[model samples]
Target chain A: MSKQVFIPRDSLNQALERLSSKMNVWVPAASGSNKCGSEFVPYRPDLIPLLNRQTTTPPKAVVFPQVETLLSYEYTKDPDNPSRVKIQLDDTSAGSPTLIFGARPCDARGFLLFDQVFTRGPFTDKYYRDRRENSYFATLVCLEWDSACFCSSVGSGPTDMEGSDLRVTPLKDGYLVEALNERAEPILSLMEGDVPTDAQQQDARKLQEEASRQRVGNVDLTRSATDFKGRFEDKAYWRAMVSQCLSCGVCTFVCPTCYCFSITDEMQGLKGERLRSWDSCMFFQYTLEASGHNPRPTRFERYRNRVGHKFSFIPEKYNGMIGCCGCGRCIRSCPVSIDIRRVVENLKENACVCA
Target chain B: MEASATTRLHQEVEASIGRLSTVLGWGAGYDPLHMTPLFVRSPEDIARLVWNPLCVQNLTGYLVKSPGVQPPEEGKKIGICVRGCDSRSLVALIQEKLISRENLYIIGIPCRGTVDIRRLMNESGLSNIRSVRIEKDLLIVDDANGAHNLPLERFLARRCLRCRHPNPVIHDVLLDEPVTPRTTAEDAYRDVESLEAQSLDQRRAFWSVELDRCLRCYACRNACPLCICQNRCIAETRDPRWLTQRVNLPEKFLYHFIHALHLAGRCTECGECERVCPMEIPVTLIKEKLNQITRDLLHYEAGLDPEAVPPLLTFNPAEAGI
Candidate 1:
């Protein structure tokens, strides 16, 4: 437990402004072209965070960028031996401390799964480790849940603060802010807030208590590793479920915990860069072989791999830690509204039957 | 629509579906303001079919894209539901011979406009919505709070505001009496005109800011009915090497160019690309500008006549030798 304080709603921007001067701060801001959507951007003096709604894209990029340069290289002709050429390598990793404000609890929880892959690896990924160790999360105690949200079903909830460094609970006209870790304590002073009154403290507790009990999604998604494994070979089942899928990358791109990537070498003259970019198993090219043989040749097979990788493969590999945090961005942003909750829940039972 | 109208539509559609390979239509989604495309092969699923301003997706892509509607068996037809804008895609597909006209049973619905759920949520601050329906010129939304009435025209999609084809150009079964179009053809390119009014630098800045937010999820391309390349799209191909995997502004700009330019003379302006974009980047404006140029320079309109070839694709033998 840490100290608690209250920052009025109007002063929230001032607190973020001050935090930005100390370290990199990301706040959810409305897109220039559309007011209905938002993305995380660096905080400026006049920037106001969209506290009411979730961002279209998560702050996952702050720790692991969408596209990252692993290393840069240049080839030069050797002076002493003309037949041999010299290769110069430059390390591209430059770690910096960052703070992500206004992240939903589900959004913050995504990092835990990422940590499992990047930090506890057979060989620790230096690029991911550098950013992961230096970043802090100031997650909001989520008060809203819609049809797509299912954090509670995934062993987490709206008020689940397992991965957050700071927990911010919304109040009537202000916020009740609490530091959950020593690294986040310094930010409370930066908020320039007053001590919460007894009434305000009660309000904060009631909100979290109510949220904790709420059923965001009416399904149990945990313990699905066996169910998924049992049905992996049921080709008829998989085909029926994914017949309507467009095989677009929307679901993977919007997912907070989906971290699959492909590395490519981009060359220009004498210099070249080794880059890593996000990849989706839904696409046909994701598993295309050099000889033009594709292991997952059809869209249904690709989609099955995606579902398996999240629920079954990760648990089999990582001691039962689920790959999904269930922020539901994938569901909400999907053009066809393919509900993943329905798919995962129905994993325990037969969803569709055909001849 | 009136309750009787909905009933009549369902009954008629249900009666005609016995011989179709599949009947493509809209079904209830996770929420009131969302709808999903449904392929109805049985009478039980017909009850799930719905029609409203919330029906936003253009389902014509299923006719041509793989894993979509498969080719009908000999002498069988593929049933589809199309609004005013979707009908144009059918004509374009027929014009290019992508889908035979004789093999379709189109149930056409006259459209006023489809609601933009994002715009409605942003403007009304509405959340936890339980129900939404249209009554005359107003949209009635019900949430945890009581019902709130809003003017429908102001909340219509940006593309809908300038719609010049509210009546399906071609149809086998017309659902309703045709409604008046929102704008005349002269005012059709108003969105492009405003963008053109800006200086060159201003235009560049506008696009730079918008494209910088693209995730390259390819939702817009997949949603487009005329983007027929599918798995062979140039944006994803290594053989052509047109683009890298970089998520920077230059790569994003080029990808948008590939999407817009490929449909330069063929875009039906259904607004699916703009609607499906999670970033809400107003991508349709890029295609609209090209459409304006095609209309002015080539003196042509696409998806209007099934037999007419697009100006860009029309062959000139004397110039082709070069």
Candidate 2:
């Protein structure tokens, strides 16, 4: 663990302004189109007020955009042989290193989760990896917790900065800076020396721990994940449970761990780019075949998959640990207020009946 | 035994439709050899119900298209007949809340693999084949060569060969004695796996050679049960045209990739996409890869049950190994 230092609360604006000169700094900005604020924009120190609140959009857009042009190509007549076909590169401009400010702890943890799923796989996504490497992350430790916040149960919480390069904790005068990765070293090196004493580290730790305890954030999901597979055949129960669900994918769109995407080619004139955008299984067409057959045509099966994957299948495939990070985003965002917490609680209590 | 099994299955369907008609006042019918939708209004019409090798149509696809049945005002239930695979789809639909369990009176059949008519046609190179008859486990194909005997298992639909669960996972009423669930591991995608095992260059070569045969007919896309976004697929859309109007290798590659990616985790190993491909493209190869991905990444199978959540919407933070 790196030592933390305090910067005067008033000097934050100046610090942001200094950082903006080097590279285009991206802070959460209001997206007028969606009437939602939180999309990253080029540095504007005036937007520091938005940093305290958690971003509406996850920081993922900063790295892996909703739609990206991986490579563009165009067809033109060859100079030497007009009859011969030739494919030429259209553009090769890549995004520069961006500094993302005020990312929440959950969003930071989301990056770590994405790292494992995307980086460890057989196919290395160069675009995502490159953007990830170039981007500098600085997260603000959460002082407040919501009912939707359950990161503590899955071993990560509001204060956990497992994936951040730099972590900032609010202090009386300003902010306490802690560098967690090599990338953060440069930023810390630039700061005036005011190293956090041993007492300060203890204080921060105690504060974070007490906050976690006071909020009662951790809900025991151990039994649910361990024993969920056996209960898969409980058709009557699961079917009844999800009978009220609407197959809208809002929960997925808001979720940080949902990496499933669909690829589409966009052609402009003779040039085209194949882009991958987020896709959800909740849609009717997600599993429906043109032959007019859909295997998962029911809401119960989709809901069961949601629970089974998080608790059983994911743990079985990755390790004994459950797949859910206990980030209760799904419970909060579901249109019908379908509480995953209650489901998990029921599963945990009923685990004794399972093998 | 096969004939009796089908007849018994037909009888069960009639009984359920009868029960549903009395209470809910709705009914079902069976299409003949072709995939034309069925409409049954009476008990006598149920005699036309045939569960032969030619029943390649996914009956679940026709359920949403009711025969003049309105919402709650019209009736309380919608009666239909479903095979084992069809029942899984129904379960998925019910679990997803697309169709209420209360609304459906399903007569579930335990399927002993359906025959692949396309594969049979290809083997004999017969264009004018008349009809298909199943005698026990033997498939009798009446073509230019009169009648030829083919082992049922040999020409069985790929989905049915490795079918471990041959009974409707969810059903209100079941028909015919459930056949002993077979653990027969049919190497359905062994060829795709072998091809994938090759180096990237070799794999590229193989795909190029195979795709070279594509005529860009879009038959495979038309045949897929999961491909319902035909009205607005990005490839053919005018608003933001995805590919060139001219048919070429690159355009075909894009179309295929989009199709495969669309079905990734959701594909239930149904071979309808490949069956309808006029160029005989093994479109299931893409679905197989996606199945492998879903199994490996999330350990979840699609369309196995109605209550299982689709993989894309479901996430486990713990699975991230945080």
Candidate 3:
């Protein structure tokens, strides 16, 4: 058996506390006092982290928060020439080194899409780039697959190690933590655990094997882009699929892979700050042009774009990296439970033909 | 097996689909614990219709919201399924003239409290569940690992616990025998009262933490049946500039208060706002507090009598104890 570091469940918080002195340690914590809602939060002494199940909100906020100030600006007028305004800007929102302690593999995989848009592009967003580069993910090998999780269907799995700096596997009494690369090596010592016994290592291996073997769904989305293209003009098909959708931003807000945002200047008199907040394609204002015409006027067209962007357009544009991570937050958090998997599958098979 | 109550309801909807444009109901989701709002257009679609404790969604919003089921022709009407709480929303819509009574065919189900799936899952440690069914007072959950029977009373939603109207106040057709209400009108605001009994600072602290967690997804506003200002909502409109895009605690507090105050006396306590909240914030509690104030000051309850206008909507100078 390979030797590995094991952090006992009891002392896991102590190790995390020790790590926090070095950098911000984010863990999957209950949103309030209830376990029903979970999000990645900066670790505190009293906070009991949730490592058992998938969090309600992803760790995307670590790199790209829902709403953040891009820059603060102020306007000043000279006494002699009041008409001439001087603009002073402050871009002080620098990112600190962060360690997301209990991110799932699907959560880690979502950053790859962000990297494609923010880092690999010609005009890089400095705020996102700094956070993306400084953040390291200790992804947990997900053993608890609910109906909402479809990581395997989207080319990611419970143990899929893409974009993960460290691998954390839960054992009965502790977690077997291992650094996948050199950058992650230092954090292992910060976990402050003893080397795993042969028996403990064997047990973790068995769990790893079990997690890798599990399958969530059998649907093949290999021909999704082409199929979606074929049915792009079928308005009736799209209408039937998402008729129950409430057109709320829950799906996109909870999604780890949805990286769309809108920038606006929030001003209080002469003092102003540019803010970047999360935006959803489901809303009417998303496609509203300056000419007062909206291309995606209704929920039907907007929802169609949502499906097309993830399965068809993103893959075609980004060299075959589908925008969806299939973390299943879109399905789980949808007020009406409009399954994206079902919609994508139906894109290939026209609803008219079946009904 | 005998035809269940849900199956019988589906049979009735199948027969009525010939005279209706579409029937709004609940269908099976990816799992048994969750239910999706189903829109049935044809006879074949009626089979998807379900009526059970898991059918927790309040479907009245679809009448006024997106892809609404209006009359296809002048003569034909639209069909809708409503629980006791949902029927109240339906009544409120009719009272406001958002939907006319003549254009609807209502299918009412007297609800005996729906399960709080999140709470049930949390307390029971049930995940990836296979099936959930009601057997009298117990809820049987099949999670592949084992079958666990949980008491139904322990998992009821907080709104359902305080429900004073378990039977539909307005319905063209009643599906089941009406059940007795769990609480009286005088004690219906017990939960809100407990929160009120706390010191003002304590309540403020509680809401400060709860509202701070808001992602500003606007799910609560979207799910509410009384919020008819869909695209023109002030919360999203930058032209008027009531609030900024900043998601700080102050912005969240303003947004929630605006949502609750907009419903003042119109909110029927359907609990859809609380149900749809992804963060599990008890947003409906805010609206209920408004309803309590309206109740005491005006001696009124919304949606019980469609003919009576909400006191807040109209100016009555002669209103007692003003």
Q: How many residue pairs clash in each candidate at the backbone level?
A: 0, 48, 0
Isolated chain B TM-score per model = 0.96, 0.81, 0.97
lDDT by residue (tens digit), candidate 2, B48-91: 55566556555453343221223433454566666666676666
Off by over 4 Å in 1: A79-81, A350-355, B317-322
lDDT of 3 by residue, B1-322 (tens): 0137697788779778888988889888878888898888878888777888878888999899866665556678889998899999998999899898998889988888988888888788887688788887788889867899998999999889999898899998888889999999889888799999999999999899889988889999988999989988889888898989989999999999999999999999999899889999889989989998988888889998889888887887777945
Error of 1 at B108 (Å): 1.3
Each candidate's interface RMSD (Å, one decimal) is: 2.3, 21.9, 1.7
Ranking by lDDT: 3, 1, 2
lDDT of 3 by residue, A123-154 (tens): 98899988888899999988877788787777
Candidate 1 per-residue lDDT over residues A2-114, each given as its tens digit: 38889889888887777888889998888764467888899998777887777888888888898999999999988898889999999768678789988998889888889
Candidates, DockQ: 0.57, 0.01, 0.70
Can you tell me the CAPRI class of model 1?
medium
Residue B211's lDDT in candidate 2: 70
Question: How high is the lDDT of residue B224 in model 2?
Answer: 52
